[model samples]
Structure formats: C-alpha cells, structure tokens
Target: MKKSFKLFLFTLLFAYQFSAGQNQKKIDHQTLTWIRYYNVLPLTEKWALHSEFDNRSFVNPIHENLFVIRIQGRYRTSKIIELGGGFAYFNVNTQNPDADPDYSIPEYRTQQDITFINDIAKITFHNRFQLEERFIQKADKNGLLDEFSFAYRFRYRLQSTFTLWEKEQNSLKGTISDEILFNYGKDNKRNTFDQNRIYAALRYHFTPNLGLELGYLKNFQRRASGVDFYDRDIIRFTVYHRINRKF
Candidate 1:
C-alpha cells in the first residue's frame, strides 16, 4: 500500500512538474466566476434523479462565458458505492460579448460515473470516475453551424470532507478536491492532457436536504495550440438540495 501510494505521488508530481515547465512564455491567465445549483430527487431507497446547472462568467471585467445544464439517473448499490448516467447541454460563447459574427456554440455530452465513499482514520473521502462522450458543433464552410464532431474524455476526482461542527440537521463542513481529465477520440487533436482542477470549499448544511457552499477553484487547461496552457481562477457559489419522501 505504501509503495503504491508513493508511486501515485511520484506520477502526480512528475506530471505537474512537466506541465509547469512547458510553454512558460505562452501561458495565459484568466479569472472566472460561477454559480452552480444542484438537486437530487429520491424516488426510493436505491434510486434517485439528479440535476445541476451552472452559470459562468469571466471576472475582473464581468462578462458571460457559458451556461450548462445536466440531468442524471443515479442508483445507489450500497453504502459505499453508487452509479450514474447523465446528459449535459452547454451554451458557450467566447470572451467578447459584442464581437461581430458571434461565436456561440451549443454542445451536448453524455456521461457515466461511479462513486465510492470511504473513511480513513477520521476523515471522510469520496472518489469518482467519470467518462464522457461529447458532440460539439462547428461552423461549416457554408457558414452554417453543424454538430458533427465527437470527443471522449475520462475524469477522476478525489475529495475529502471534514466536519467542523454538527448538531441535528445543521452543520458546517470543509472540503478539498482534486480532479484531472484526459481527452481522446477522433476530434481531439490538441494535447492529451486536457485539464486539472483543484478546489477548496466550506459548506453549510441548513437542513437535511439543503446546503450552500462557497469555494475557490483553480483550473489548468491545455489550449488547442497544444503547447500553451491557461490558468483560470474561479470564485464559486453553489446551492445544493435533495428532495425525498417517506416510502
């Protein structure tokens, strides 16, 4: 176990070290802000529907970038494991709002994910593996937009949540998470290293089914130029809720 852990740490360090040393002169920096909403509707003890939305904007000047919505059907197999399938739709635009010939894109994706939860010592940990099939739109030579390109990506996330205080349905918690993504498929011509996200948040559980979270996230992304990268800093606000009835 110790050897495997050391190997994982070594790989992570090497990857980041390599990325940090690449295209130092071409790195782009951006600030972003987002508000996210999450919901869960439990139909039974083992089945649930989940949905989420995100409104994203670039900060430091305040302009819109994208909006996204996703829906999922989730099945809980046990206390420690769950599986889900979802679809997401995205309306995305480039940074400029008034640019002539607006470059707005509509995107679609289907996703599957497996979630695992466990506790080590006193800290609670959650791990997720997600795979996505993406269909992206592009403007054809005739100047008509068409969706004809496909892409695939795999993502993994590890998160730990620690309780600060708890009393009945009210509590405070802190969480930290790291996620990495790799992309493939026919349409993906850029770097294989897609993105990495690091996040930290504080959450307040006001009721058994509702919570609010405020967080900070840093995103590192490989650009289409293949060598250049961007560092995006995001300020996040999220509302999460669950709806369930006695069954």
Candidate 2:
C-alpha cells in the first residue's frame, strides 16, 4: 500500500509541472510578439534629464503647423518616491493666406511620481501627479489675454516592461501604458476642458541606454472655447537615451 501511495504522489507532481510549463509558454508567446519603447526615459538612478522635439501636421488645409519642444528632469527622493518638473513650448503657424500670423504658447509643469518594484519579475508600477500653467500670445486677443493663464491638470499613467531576449549587445523590450487627464481652473473654461490619451509602443535596444520607439497615440480633447471636440490619431517615432546612470 505504501508503494502505491508513492507512485500516486509522483504522478500528481509530474502533471502539475507539465501544466505550469504549458501556461508559461503561452504567456511568453503572447507578450513577446511586439516590443515597445517609452519616450519618457527610465529612472534607474537618482537623477535624470531628457529632452525631445516633435512636429505634427494635419490633413486639413485651413489648419496650422504644430511644433513642440519638451524638456524633462527627474530626481529620486527614495526607493519608492520621485520628484520632477518640465516645460514645453508650442508653436503654431497658419498655412492659409487668410489666417493670422504665427503664434506661440508656453506651458510649464511640475510633477511627482511613485513606483513600486517587484523583485521576482522586476515589474514596476508607477503613479504620477502633476500641475501645469499655460501662456498664449495671440495678435487678435486684447490686453489681459496676453498674460499667462493658470490651469491645473491631473494625470495618471500605468506602465510595465518585460525582457524578451537579452544578449551581450542587443535586447528587446515591450511596454504598455495608458494615461488620463483632467483640467481645471479659470482658463479651462469653468473646469469643462479635459483630455484623454492612450499609447502602445514597441522598442528595440541596441544598448542598455539607447533605443528607438514606435507607437500609436489616440488623443481626445474638449476645448471650452470651442463647440466641437477634437480627436487625433498620431503615429510617433521617438529616440531614447539615458546618460549618467547605472542599472
């Protein structure tokens, strides 16, 4: 009877191992199909600085050309907390001959983020909160309109990374993240303006600190000053590099 019991226990263990292995194989296949890279540089160390420029154009003939410059800085306060701030400048130039001349807008923001890392899989969960103010200069608007207007914005983003294959000189990473935004204050037109953005990307890294990212972005914005809602589909290509960090 004791010999029979041992045989049964061995069979059960073998079956459990086989099932777990199959599940892991399925997960690997699904997650590794596409690799993703992030434009927001990873904070692997105590301090980081990053900057990039983006240009966008629309199919509409009456619209304007859009160019954006972004600068970001981050500092780690602790194992789980981080503080950072950045500013962005936007330039919009009209294409139509009947339209007004070029105009520029500047936006400044400060933010804090917290992260929790899991040791086993090395997965990290990041939470971010921020505040921003924007200034717009237009030739048509009067005196007070030229002044900077204050608007408060709140955002939440969740992202994760998984290592597919790591060799001596090359690696692939897959990233998935989503963000939601809310705007408040006087310039937000009585707290009615809001925006929602979502992105999915794939990245290939030739080195640990340098890589390229290609992604799709969906943006929805409601302007309090306008009657229509603006929806945009954006294809983004970004280059990422981290300097002065050890991971």
Candidate 3:
C-alpha cells in the first residue's frame, strides 16, 4: 500500500512539473534557504498550543527575504480530526539584488484550519485545510510601505509520514507533502491560483516529543494577474520540540 501510494504521488508530481514547463506565463526562478523553530505546549490530551519562527533568505548566493512568526491553539476532537486557529506576521523583501532588502512588505494573517490524521499500516497520513484573511502592506505613491489591502485565501495540504527506522517510538521518518493555495474575496479578483508547494523531508526523532526535519521544498506562485510566476527552490531545516503538562 505504501509503495503504491508513493508511486502515485511521484507520478502526479512529475506530471505537474511537466505541465509547468508547457505553461506560457512569464517565469522567474530563485533559491531560498529557510530555517524554522517549532514548539508545542500540550495543556491536556485534547488541547495544545503551537508556535513557530522562521528565517528565510533569497539573493542568489545569500540574503534575507522573509521572516515569520506564528502562534496557534488547537483542539483535538478525535484521533482523526482537529481544529486550530492562528495568527501570523510576515516581513517580506524583494529578491532583486538592486532593491533594498529592508523587509518593506509586512503582512498580517489570521488563519483557521481543520486537520485529519490517520494511521494505517505504520504510515501516517495528514490532511489539512486552511482559510486565511490577510492584511498585506502595499507601497504608497512615494514608494514607501504605508498602505495596506485585504485578501482571503484557501489552502489544502496532504502529507504522509513513514518510519524508515525505529527504536521504540523514536524513529527516523520520511515525509512528503503537497499544498495548493487559492485566492478569493473582493480585493483579490485576478489570480485564483495563488501558489503550490511540494515538499520532501526527513525527520529524526530524538524522543517521542522532539525531532528535527531537513527538507527540500519547491514553491510556485503566480502574480495577481496570473501572468507571471515565481518558482522558488528552498532548502529547509527545522527543529521541533514539544512539552506535556500533567494536572
């Protein structure tokens, strides 16, 4: 079953890439290096808080492009379903070397998500659907970042985790995930296909609650008009930590 699923995913990814090559949109390519720190604070068997910080860079060889901070509270209604809401702030800069990388673009986002987790034959599948309301900074007539606009988006991600090697619950695992983003609302009219991300990673569990993930992510995003696209190749490193409190 695992092999069959993996094969299907790879084939789908291959087909998507092939279609991308045939697309007529103007394309730009860049490399982004990203590192993330993630933490979970468990209040009870059914409740938890999640937080994350990220540093992302893109400037050919190296330069800062973005930074992000997010916090979320989650309720696990069942082993197979969970609900979460979060807020995030992002500071973004253009990747152009000639442009000042001062993080001129600041975005505030509120998000809600529904997640499903199922374990089957030592493999775990996770599906997450998210809706976001965004307040994004824009440039004024003077070219200063003093204006803002609102937009809404929807995203869906499918991910799988397989244990490659194990020592009790501490194991080395591999993960593959793909996500698609769509835009809506009154402010966003031109581009419906906002972005897509494909990720492959390896996670090493230090304990039942702590782990590290090293991964590669490919991201494609379209401009509001859907006439231009950005293809980003990202190298990602993440540290994961969790704490459980007993009452």
Candidate 4:
C-alpha cells in the first residue's frame, strides 16, 4: 500500500510538470473564498446519506464564481470499505475573474464512488475513488441555452486526519488532503488532465456530531484550450454535521 501510494504521487507530479512545461499561454491567477456545509445522516447501521452545499466567489473585487449542491447514498460493506452513488448540480460562472458576471452555466453530474479507510495509531487515512458523468449546458452566440455537452471524469483523493488535542468529547484535529481529476469523452478532447487540489485545514469539534473547519486550498486546473490554466488560491470555511438515530 505504501509503495502504491508513493507511485501514485510520483505519477501525478510527473504529469503536472510535463503539462506545465507544454503550456505556452498565460496562466490565470485568482484568489477566491468558499463557504460550505456538509452533512451526514445515518439511516441504519450500514446505510447513510451525505449532502453538501458550497458557494464559491472571487476575492478582492468580489463576485460569484460557482455554487454546488451534492448528495449521495452510501452503504458500508465492512469496517473499512464504503460504496456510494450520488448526484450533483453546479452553477458555474465562466467569465474572467475581473469581468462582470455574465450568464451562468448549468451542469448536472452523476457519480459513483468507493472509499477505503484505515487507521494508524492516532491518525486516520481515507482513500476515495469516484467516477462522474457530466452534462453541461451550452450557450449560443446570444448567450441563450443551446444544447448539452456530455463528458466523464475520474477522481481520486487521499486524505488524512490527526488528533491535535482531545478533552472528553471535544477535540481539535488537523486534516490534509489532495485530489486529482481526469476528464474523458468526445467533448473533452483537449484537456485530459482536469485539475488537482491540495488542502490543509484545522477542525474543531464541539461534540462528536458537529465540527467546523477553516482551510486553505490551492487548485490548479487546465482549460479546454490545453494551453491555458488557472491557478486558484482559496480560503474555505466549512461546517460539518452528523446525525445518528438509535433504533
């Protein structure tokens, strides 16, 4: 497992370097902020629902960037393995960061995923793999909704958490995660490497069922042009809630 993890990291780094060296066009750099809320509700010992809402915006000058809503039904097969399927909706602002907001694009996504969890001493590791089918609304020259473009994407994330402090039921934790994504299909010709995100956060739990997190995330993305890119620096604030029912 350790060797495979190292290989995966090395491959991602190599691909990123190769792609960066090939891009001759200017890269768009932007600063952004994100506010998010996530929830987990347990229906039974083995079944659960996960839901999330995220709002993203540009900083400094300040304008809307994107808004997302996602939900998933998850089933645990064992202590370490969980399977999930989900749907997501995205409202994307395709305009430049400095430009005024134009017509937003609508996107629908269906996703399937599996996660593997492990623990080593006080630290926990989560390896998640997901596949997404995306239908993105297109616009004509008049900016009217035209047709829908279809694509597929694959995503993988490795996340870890460490207990920083603990007193009774309340605790403080540190989290670090990295995710890489790839795009494919007839519509995704130019950009095969979609994006990579690196995140680090500090989380505080008032109880076992609720927590708040503040994080910094860096997202590097390749555009459909294949030559252009976006380097985004984002500050994220998140609320996490979990509900469990006793039967």
Candidate 5:
C-alpha cells in the first residue's frame, strides 16, 4: 500500500510539473507568521474529538492574513488505522498584502480522511488522505459578497517523526511533513493542482499530555489564472494538548 501510494503521488506531481510547461510563471513572494493551537479529547478508548484554531498574519507591515477553526471526530479502528470526518471555517484576506483595505472572505468546508500509521526502526510515519467540499463566498469587483462557489479538493499528506532525545516522559523530536492538494469541480477552471506545503519542526514535550512545536512552512500555490503563483514563507508556533476521560 505504501509503495502504491508513493507511486501515485509521484505521478500526480509529474503531471503538475508537465502542465506548468515553459510559460514564464509570475510569482508573488511573501512572508507570514502563524499561531496555532490543537487539542485532543478522548471520549472512549476508540473515539476522540480533535479541535484546532489557527491565526495567520503578514510579517512586514503586520496585517492579518487568515483565521481558521476546525473540529473533527476520529475513530481508531485498529492500532494502525484511523478514520475521521470534520468541519472547518475560514476567514481569509486578500493574498496581496499591499491591498488598500484587506477584505474578509468567508469559507465553509466539510471533509473526511483516513490515516495509516506505521512504525519502523523507531521512526513513525503517518499517511493521510482527505477529501474536502468547499463553499466559498464570492465577491464582486467592489469586494461585495456574492453567491457562494463550490469546489472539491483532494489532499494527501505524508509525515514522519522520530525521537531526538528522551528522558522518562519528557522528550524532544523533529518532524517533517508534506501535503499536496488538487482541486476539481465546475468552479475550478484553470488549475487542478491547487497547492503544496512543506514543513519542518522541532517539538518539545513537557509531559505526555502537552507539547509545543516551532516550525517553518513553505507553501507554493497556483492561482485560478494558472499563470500566477504564490510562494509563501511562514513561521509557525503551535501548542498541542490532550485530555483523557470517559463519560
């Protein structure tokens, strides 16, 4: 399964590169900071609730970029497989940080995912595949809200983590992850390859239930025009918390 999944991802990536062609792509470069919080609450041995809050901001002039909230229910079917479904809300600003007044665009998304976990030689790998239904509020030339546009997105992420140092329950670890996204539906006109994200982080665990991560992420995205792209560098700080209980 892992080999097949890797082959599929490589094929998709090849297609994206081939489609890019020789056209001189216009790129917009920007720097941003992201703050995030993640929580996991166990309802039972096999059921859990996961929640996330994220805030993003532009760096140079200090402007808000995006805000997001997500909630999901996860069920562990076995030691190595989990299934999850979730809802997410997003408030986004213009991708151009230099816009006179940053307008807010709202989006609602519902998604489902399956995750496979593997442990080999003390390194743990997670492979996650997800599908999303997105409803984005459109805007007119004057930035007035219009009817919503619907789209479907598919995402695949591969992540790996290994212990860097360990003493009792407190430890430090390094993580690397990559996610690729593709878009489909009537609303997606020019591009099927939406974006790709690459991230690396150092995480510190204070206890079994709490941890902190500092990471850097690079996002490369193709716009609706297909000729325009965004290259974003982001600094991210995250807090992870877990609560275990039964009701």
Candidate 6:
C-alpha cells in the first residue's frame, strides 16, 4: 500500500509538470531568498490563531522588503470535515538607486479551507480569495508608479498526508501538495502575476500529532503580464501539532 501510494504521487506530479510546460513562459534568472517562522495557537474548542513572519531579500542589486500578518479561526463540522476562515494584511516597500526615495502599499485578504480524512491519508483543499486596494501616497506623488486601485486574486490548493511506517515510539510520514494562483480584476486587469507550486515532504513523528518535516518546493511564477517565468527551488522545514478540547 505504501509503495502504491508513493507511485501514485510521483505519477501525479510528473503529469502536472508536463502539462504546465506546455504553457510556460521564458525563464527569469532573478531570485528572492527568505526565512519564515509560523506559530499556531488555540483559543477555544473550535478556534485557533496563526501567525507568521518572513524576511526576504531579492538578488537584484536593488533589494526590496515585504511583510504580512494574518489571523484565522477553525470550526469542526464532522469527523471528516473542517472549515476555516481568515484575514490578512500585506505591506511592500522598495529601495533602489534608480527609483524614488521610498515606496509603500497596504492590502487585505480573506480565505477558507475544507478537509477530508480517510484511512489511507488525509486530504485538505483550500482557497484564498483576496481583494487588494493599493495605496501609494509617496510613490504616486513622485510619479514613479500609479496611485491606487483594486486587484482580485485567489489561490487554490490540494494537500495529502500519509503515514509510511508506524511503531510504538515513532512513525514516518509522507506528504504531497500543490497550489495554483490567479490574479485579475480592475487594478490587475492585465492578469499581471500568477503562480504554480508543487512539493513533496517527509516527516518523522515523535507523537501522533507532533512531527518535523523536511521538504522540497518547486515554484513557477509569471510576472507583470510579460512572457517571463521565474522558477525557484526551495528547501522547507515544518512542524505539526494538534490538540483536542471538549466544551
């Protein structure tokens, strides 16, 4: 069963990549490097809080910074189904010798997710639908970029996790996941940016709900409505924890 599952995951990933290549754009060499930290906190029986911080640097001589914050809640509907929603805030700033002195923009977003569990593995499907109205006070005054407008975007994701080996003390687990994003609407009418990502991960669990994961992430993106693609190879570390409460 374990071998079959692994084979299935490999086949699916290969198919997805092959299909994506047919529509891929020209490659870009610029890169962005970042470190992220995430924490999950329980508030009540069916509520939770999550937060993350990221520090990123662009390889381009002109480096920029991006920051985001989010808060969310989860509700359990049945043994196989869970629902969640959240709001997020985003800010971006750029510093370049050729550009103006400084620039900044802020935005907001909301999202939801559903999950299913089976003996073979657990699956989670989620979507993040966002509306961002950019505010560029300083940059606009300098006539560097447009002032403000609304952009609509959404991300669709599917993820699965399976236990490979289980013993009294520890277990080995495997995960496969994919996400695709679409951006559109008035401010982004040009369909400026989009992203597709796929990943495979392995975990070592000390307990049923606690584990450490090591993973490889393959990400592809299209930027600014041009026929240019950016590909990134990422190494990720993840930690998992779950808690139950009765009300």
In terms of lDDT, the best-performing candidate is 4
| Candidate with the larger TM-score of 2 and 5 | 5
Q: What is the lDDT of residue 62 in candidate 2?
A: 34
The list of candidate 3 runs beyond 4 A from truth reads 1-22, 95-98, 101-103
User: How many backbone clashes does every candidate have?
Assistant: 0, 6, 0, 0, 0, 0
lDDT, each prediction: 0.82, 0.55, 0.83, 0.87, 0.87, 0.59
Taking all chains together, each candidate's TM-score versus the true structure is 0.90, 0.67, 0.88, 0.93, 0.91, 0.67
Please report, as a residue range, the 10-residue window in candidate 3 with the lowest summed lDDT: 94-103
- Candidates ranked, most accurate by lDDT first: 4, 5, 3, 1, 6, 2
Candidate 6 regions with alpha-carbon error over 4 angstroms: 1-25, 30-34, 57-65, 93-101, 116-147, 166-170, 206-210, 239-247
lDDT (tens digit, per residue) of candidate 1 on 1-247: 3432443365467458867678554777889888999999998989999999999998766678899999999999998899999999998776433332455678899999998877766677777889999887876434436456788999888778888999998999899877888899766677678888879999999997899999999888887558788788889999999985888
Model 2 clash pairs are 35-202, 35-203, 36-174, 36-201, 36-202, 36-203
| Candidate 2 segments exceeding 4 Å error | 1-45, 59-64, 94-101, 106-122, 138-145, 190-193, 244-247
lDDT of 6: 0.59
Q: Could you give candidate 2's per-residue lDDT for residues 15-133 as a string of tens digits?
A: 34433444422211001011223255556657676676776654443343456677778787777677777777766553232455545444444444444333234544454556555
Question: For residues 45-91, what per-residue lDDT tens digits would candidate 5 score against the true structure?
Answer: 99999999999999877788889999999999999999999999999
Clashing pairs in 4: none
Q: Which RMSD values do the candidates have, in order?
A: 2.6, 14.3, 3.1, 1.8, 2.5, 5.6
lDDT of 2: 0.55
When 3 and 5 are scored with TM-score, the better candidate is 5
Q: Better model by TM-score, 3 or 6?
A: 3
Q: Residue-wise lDDT of candidate 6 within 1-247, one digit each (tens)?
A: 4543454466457547744764655675544555455566677765677666555445455465456676667676765566677776766664222343455655556666665433443433322223333333224545345444555566555566676898996999887777666776654555454677777889897986567777877777665554566666656666665444345
Better of 1 and 5 by TM-score: 5
